[model samples]
Target chain A: MATKKKVTRKNTTTNKAKAKTKTPEETSPAMDNPYISASFWKAMWIICSISVLLEFFIHRHKHFEDLESSVLGNISNWFGFYGMFGLIACSGSILLAKGLSVFLKANEDYYDDTP
Target chain B: MRIITMTLLNNIPPAFLLIIGAFVLLILPARARKVGAIALAFFGVYAVSQLVEGSNVTPEFLGFDLTLLRVDSTSKSFGYIFTLSAFGALIFSWSERCRLQNTAALVYVGSALGVVFAGDMISWYLFWELMAISSTFLILARNNKRSRLAAQRYILVHLGGGLVLLTGILLTIHETGSIDFTKENIYQNTVAKNFILIGILINAAAVPFSSWLPDAYPESTIFGGVILSAYTTKTAVYTLVRGFPGEEILIPIGCIMAVYGIIYALLENDIRRILAYSIINQVGFMICGIGIGTKLAIAGVVASTFCSIIYTSLLWMAAGAVMYRTNKSKCTELGGLYKTMPITMVLVMIGALAVSGAPLTSGFISKTLITAAAEHQNYLWAWLALKVASAGIMLHTGIKFPFFVFFNVDRGLRSKEAPRAMIAGMSLMAFLCIYLGLNPGQLYSIIPNSDILVEQVSFYAIYIKHFDHVATKFQMLLFSGLSFFLFLPMLKRTRTISIDFDWFYRKGAKLLYSGIDKTFNSINRAAEHIVIKTFLPSLVKFIINAPASLTIMLFRPIWEESLSADKTNIKKREQKIISQFSSGTFPVAYSAIFILIFIAILIFLGRSLS
Candidate 1:
């Protein structure tokens, strides 16, 4: 997604002056206000760390205790399985959505207006 | 039978109060209308709250007993939420001057309550159609070209569903000679049952027919969209629970809808359209629960339905406030709205977390019931799919909605806060979302059937003790959030929509209509050629020549006799004939003269009329 930055003359002049002082890469729009900033990712890392560690101490019970537990089930029983599964599922779903969009995406005006 | 004193007053169904309230609001002076509507909401809630199960009021309609008001725990559970939603929506739309939108919204909500309370199939059908028609006006009330078109499509799809449902009801009645709204021995293979299921699925926004929800909902007026998000699908869920619990097929259908909604929402750019898709995804969870058919599962369906109605409506209301203030709906066109509209953003976040099943939120408690039920039933595949879908929900709705609309790169747009009325309405629902989540006993107590209630209570009591289950859910959601940032590039908003089965009807129907038109045109063209090249000219020639030819033939014999009598007589007759027939081809000339005169006269008459 391209972020729309309104470039007024005053703002442009300030940016140009700043460009004279700062490196071009630092002045790039993408670097200036990234959608997910370094600060946000830092917070995310901390949250993930806490949650990943917390998974170890939690005691969970299964609804179907009598079901034949297998290797996959045993693996899921390990700590952080849900976290790992979620990461994989989320990534997979995003990729799947992107893949589906290749076939299903169309011009927003696919339905005409004249009726 | 117990004797009742308030036969006329108390027996009046809450549905009628709302219907009557709509008319009363319409008639009251403009200054008094809002007050009148608020009063009606109060009365309606009170009326519904007072209703007792099994104390049905049956009215005779065409020699059949019509259950106009069948109060039960199931009906009351739905009634409580429906009336509550109406109250919130009424306050949300308090500033609306359009009487039609107001009245229609009331009728729409009232009819949903009626469907919830209806004890007979015929009355259900009547209230069902009333819902379809009245809700349509909410879309049409926008009165713009897009809304007009969307409203038309919306009604057509609903009417189509309504017809299918009416067909099912009629068939069931033919087979069983009863119209009571109770469990019937409808087999999976039966045509009537399938018809009924498909009809309800259409309203539920289940797969194949699901596109209508996204197609039409985003186009409604703000309050209209808010009210619309509440009743239609939830009523269908209520009906499904009443009509077909444990059907088994709904499990797969629901699972598909759950994932399908996520994929579509992932690709959507419009904020409200994303919310609309989430409605489908959330309902899918409920439907899956209903399919499990265990007491816990059914309770989950009812509880989730209740929670979904509030949280989804809140999401829409918050999004609507943004659109109202900024006049932009597409995510690509919105960002940093939180700067000016902080309250709206906070409310939306609350709705978002609630929908994502965050701990101590309505969705967490309600969704667990279904997932746990799937586990108890040993439906491993369903349990896994639902868990993944749970993660998917957090991705698409819980984060995507607020991230794009409020927290993304600044679009440099500023706006005033949402109006107080809208804020009040959202706050009420936001409070309820947390209240219901933190204390689910209030919600569980309302689920129909005593047996189900007991099971639900035990399930609730036990589920909280499972630290692992709660921990896993949090891990999934937190990791899902992590995945979202990792794949942020792939999830960029785009100004495109994913085409679904509606393509068949929206485009295919256009193709079919034009094909019919082309066929008619070709037939018309062939007829035009025959008429113009052959029949028309021949008829014209005949008409012109016939009169002149007939006159000439009739006078010829008399003229010949006069010519033979004397040269002097012949000379005068020949002079007269020469003067009249100066052209060499006299009959052809006469035909032309007649044709010109006939055409001139027709033109003269045509001109005179104008």
Candidate 2:
């Protein structure tokens, strides 16, 4: 019984040492999370709101006033030309690049033998 | 004393100073060499600026007057960037002990300067080949298998282009009896014009040949990449502006280059390769601007080329710094670097923003000019493509480069900041980025024909008063950031590089060579059977058995051998010859075949002459 108690004490001491050596990041569950924090989401919301609010307050200029105005051009002048066209362009390019990679991406060794 | 001052003021091409300085670098003590190279570069810049506008020199070579130097607005602008690039690169690479690289870089930059000031087709071709050869050494200076192979491919492609360019120059000379390289209606479907365009487009990284830039640039040494990024494509752009401005076909070609770069960059794992593709993308805009052919468009093209040199060099410097510190380039292999390498991260981000045309940066000032010109010319499709490409720039270069390489996953790498020399180099570029952004007038005034525009329109009215423009730009950039994060999962870094068209050359050539070898093997077998089995045996029998005076005199057998022995000897020789006919076994025979062909050519020429 005494020997068993001594082993348990030794185990507990090792556990304490392990805990002491743990990184600050490992100790805190909140910090260890790889996902973006709630604060980031809140900040993003504020940025999005500012984009919308600025468009409403500021007077717009016509781009390419001489040429036949594009249909998308008229729609772009609304509450964000508003953030809509830019967003679509941004997301559209990303998706397009992604689609391209489906056929194009290969292992780094794709040209290994050549160069 | 007056003569000395006159000589300094003489229209001596500044390329002489740099080319001579390259040789001088080898003799100078290591410590002085760096300082000497830098001084030479700055002096070259001064010399270029002092040059007067005219056909400066007509050095006679082989009875042909080659215009060795021409100082004009276009040449001056290009010379400005080329010399400035040498200065920045020398500063960044100060710690590199390889004097050979120093020499190669000097020669590379010197030759590019030569191309800029070259007035005649002959001088242009000379400098063009020199630029290609010298830059190959820069790639080779890395001294690794990958770099060596890349350098080999690089030289082969450049030499091929140089050959095409030479043919075009010769044809032009033959047809027009002039060696001048001035703007002409070269796009009227002439073979010479098409060849010249193809040669220039290869260097510009347009479409199919675009693979070479990304294939080679990433494999360059750290500082070599910075210098490499500045010269080749920009020189091509300068040539295009000089030779083929307003050529309608270029607009579509340029658009393809722009979009293609973005696509390849999005899938690239190596940071340097991404920047390489970005070079194509940026050069594409300039090409498009040149195609538009308006004064504002040309100015925009020049400004963008100039701004790109600064910002792109900064990115290369930053990426080199990261690679120098961590010895890693793949995005997947690098992360949490911002914690240790904050300065590098910050500098890289500044470059990123500049390239993405963030508000109040060099890119915004330059890229907008081109888009505005496109709109003014009513190239709606081109304008729209440019806008989309701008967003794509934001995706791959602006956010992806910094976010993945520095901020994302912490790979537990702790490294010191870039060396002080590199930091100084990057700081200089960053300062220019912001300075030019705030006061584009400094750049605008230098533009050859923008003097009138500069005086009339307040920059504030153009850039700031249009609340819609600024607001829309901001929304695009900021929301692009949003989409990056929202779609971060799909954009995760992977250990892969996208396959490009070089696969056709690298793999397709192998297939071709093998196919030819297989066909040649069968032909060889049939010829061998006829020669060794039938013809040689019958000839030997005739010689031995005819017993003529000629046969007796030639043979004079050393030993009294039986007829059977002689026949056995002939049979053994036939077997030996047949065995030697195995596939690719007789390398000596290949040389013999070539010799025979050469002799045949000589004989044919001799007979024709007689």
Candidate 3:
């Protein structure tokens, strides 16, 4: 009985030390609260869905009628044209930046060693 | 006394009043300087408001009729915003005790006002250089090695830019025999116009010369960033509208700037550098508008400048607040700050949304006007590019900034809310962003060419005048936000900085230094070797041996014949004589004979000449 008690005490102390030394990511309340994260993602999706749905109900005046008719056709008048364009532009910019980063990105101290 | 005071108020430009106030700040207690700055800024606004629509002060300068203060719709609008931004920046920095920065801030503001109001090229150039010099102290006030280096580079670039501007002005003056800073005088000489355009574009942070903005601004003292954001580029835009309206080149340049800013901001890790790039992006929109140069486009540019100054400063202030509380600036180092600094997070969101041109914000109203102008002008590519940039703004500043700073995965950082003064300053700008956005008519009324904007307002009856514009912008920005989350993994912040045009100066400067060292210094080394090592020693040896050698040559023939049987004895004697001459112990008669010989040679030459 005495040996078992000692083992339990040692285990508790080690567990406490582990908790104490946890990384910020592990200790963060937001990280532990899965419900909040889930709800936030849900809210984001709902908001985005409504925005896309509103595109169908709302009629957008085409700024480039000639170009649209000649090349893009009615694609610009589609329900999610603005949304898709936004998506493509944003994603394209990020991807392009990522590609460029291979050449352009440098260590944070890049300018520090320089005169 | 009353009459003198009234005359002084009427004759002295409001800009000069703020400058005088800056000197006054020097004498006041450290605590009082802040209040003094705010009061002076308010007084400047009132003085600007009271001015009539002509040159307010004309001073004779070196036989030139200098217009010290000129008031027009454009200058008036710029003047009001400059003073107002000064007031806001002063309030934000109230807690700061650095008297030099406080004084420099006031002077900086004063000189920016001076640039807008100056009616001649000379005074404009003077104020422009003063603006550059005074604003540099704001960066140096950080008093760190990095900030020091950044300030040095900032001043050098501005001085170079000022020289270019002065060259342009001098050329324009010579060509026209007038110093008036009018479009007619400027555009009369093509070279002068191009020089002036390049000068202003450098300040405007247009592509290649733009790296200075991001390089220096983020390194500034926290409050300095807020003040720095408001004036320099906006003043350049003001000048562009005043001088280079309808220049077609700015259209392409502005497009490239917009796209460049978006790409860089996407790659930047520092929160403040991202804001700095967005300044370029926002200025690009205005530059594009100025290029359009229609009455509607000009009005849009002016209105957008006013709105951009407020919103961009707001964003800087919020970032500064975060930096102040946590002493961390990189987005990768910060996360879940909303838990501790909710007020700052909210203010930043407002600023971020406004910058993104979200619905019912000041950006929405101002940014749409530019696009509307582009569409009206049938520049389909510019319109499409601008729309893409608008969504780009949403991606970089709107979502990326706030997300990485406040809402990303928790980093377990904690800090109290920003100082009350910061909050108050931010709230003031935030209120204006929303206020001007909700009621853009207030801003439109103050903008240059207001009549055209009003006409367009009625024409677009579908824009802010209706809900369709709102819906369209909403659909675009929200979808952009959706894209942000979908690609969150790709947008991960790393502890890295993206190379910019400054790479030429930052890295290329060292390359240049080494190149010069190798070329010039090596030549210098060769010259030293020839003169000191080879030439000097040989010349000394020849001079020392001259008299002895002459004696030896003269006597060697006689000795060789006389001592033909005793050649060894003659050789020993000759060596002894040469040693005596080198040791300065030779007979005086030989030196006398040599001097005589030199005199005889001179006499012979003189005889020949005769």
Candidate 4:
């Protein structure tokens, strides 16, 4: 019943900007540069800031202990060891995608308007 | 111990009642069935809280196996809320006559109940799939082409997750070799750990695979949408709590979902679709609590799981009401509905507040705990993000939904409120949300740790006491004040469907599908053209020229005379045969075999899983 053209646009640019603010890909959706979108750079700084805070402050607890017995405990030792590495490696792929976007992106409509 | 045993005993009667309800709804007369379902559902709900005897209560049938029919405080609470979901769903479907819908919803709930109480992975898997299949039937009962397609896609994604889950199960069994489905932080084998995480994340409707929900749900039948709101995803949530609590990724994934849902919903036109996305958002909170992985956080997840069930169903109840009455769900098509359907409007507003995590609603008690848990874990960014998204929830669900659907200018039409049963069904939930929020201590007791009560009870008290806390007293006053101002600009009557993630699939991928379809079709035509017009014609000319060329091929004169007579009759007969075989449709055997082979593939899949 309602038509799209009749619906007034409300600062589409700003609205999209706001939506991007909380998006999960805010830091890096692609890999290469990882800083392609200005918003993503800002989100990264935010993450780095918070993660630094968490590691330094909250993790400063004496609860961390090494288990010398039981098979389950030994198993957790490996996961704690490897899972962190896995996360870091996966994060690299994301960073690279962001960087590579710079080279692949061509002039607007390189397929059509240029010709 | 006695308390656990009694609770286990309490659960058995309801299980029997539901198993019976599942069959009765299929075999009985329609009118008689509705009444029977309601009565059975009521008693089943009552038994959830009444029969609890102890904490480690297991009920075994046919010997020696321990089945924790009633286990810990958390399981009991989930079991109780799931029963509540079952009751509400029964009432919502009271007038819905699709026998398949009723039967499927019944067994779906029972299977989910089984999952919650299951003490083993094998049992959980059985119930997990039962929920998936029965729920798919509910979607298919909508009996539309779109729903049928969505159902197929839905099954594919879930079945994929199921396979991954099976893979995880096998690996875990190989390593730990234990079937006990209790909590385990066994990320010992990285491969098995990631497999389980991926499998779990898929069902949790975390990224890349979240499309099935919003895509399939809105296409479901009238009340089909109701039961779809529960069971499947939450069962996955239950599994995550037991299997992978305190895992860090769930925090980020869940937070992403919380914000993702609101943003996409902000752009969506379909109310049911928006609410479907909101289900992910709510489940996100539960998963986040599990990530925090503490006593308070688990309590938060359990309470929020129940709140999501109640509030999500309530939101759908109102949206489904609008669709049922007007046959329109897009916000652009709906407005000023509050004038005609006051009760629906009021219930919708209440549902909206609960959804926005407004103070003094069920959401407040359940959702606040999750945010607090994140803060306790010192996830400051997540904390800040969740709070902003909380406000965004207000904008998207709380304000935007009600504002556009009801409060926007009149569309020059009138509509009736939902059926009496639907209204009664929603009212029960709206009442509970407030009842639980104001009296959160009542809810806190069911959460496992004793320490939870001491910390949370006081926290809720501060909020409750702030301004004549009569549950709705503070909420109503606060909401009216906020809604009257912040949502003013968004409430303008001018309208359009905001763009969303589905736009990539619904519109963009649709364009891709159609483009690919056309390209293949034309390529097929071009190939046909080359073969039929060129190669086949050349072959025909060659065949005609080869042996039958001229006089030699024409046999001797006398033999030719006899053959000509015979050939003339044969030509006539052949003409008649051609006329008889010609029909303007695919042969019956063609369609039958095509469908049969298609089903054959599904059967193959089922076999392969074993």
Top TM-score model? 3
**Which regions of candidate 4 are displaced past 4 Å?**
A1-115, B1-17, B50-70, B455-460, B464-610
Error of 4 at B72 (Å): 1.5
Candidate 3 i-RMS = 3.8
Model 3 ranges off by over 4 Å: A1-25, A28-36, A66-79, B1-10, B455-465, B519-610
In the order shown, the candidates' DockQ scores are 0.37, 0.30, 0.36, 0.02
lDDT of 2 by residue, B339-370 (tens): 88888888888889999888778898888888
lDDT of 1: 0.83
Q: TM-scores for chain B, in order?
A: 0.83, 0.85, 0.85, 0.76
Model 1, C-alpha of B593: deviation from truth (Å): 49
Q: How many collisions between residues are there in candidate 3?
A: 0
lDDT of 3 by residue, B426-494 (tens): 999999989887777788888888887665443245354566678867888987888887777788888
DockQ score, prediction 2: 0.30
Question: How do all the candidates rank in terms of TM-score, highest first?
Answer: 3, 2, 1, 4
DockQ of 1: 0.37
lDDT of 1 by residue, B46-157 (tens): 7777776675688899889998888878888899889888888788777778878779888999999899999888999999999999999999999999999999989999
lDDT of each: 0.83, 0.82, 0.86, 0.67
Model 1 chain B is weakest, by summed lDDT over 10 consecutive residues, at B1-10
For lDDT, candidate 1 versus 2, the one ahead is: 1
DockQ of predicted model 4: 0.02
Q: Which regions of candidate 2 fall more than 4 Å away from where they truly are? A: A1-34, A69-79, B1-7, B185-189, B455-459, B519-610
TM-score of chain A of each: 0.61, 0.62, 0.60, 0.27
TM-score per candidate, chains pooled: 0.82, 0.83, 0.83, 0.66
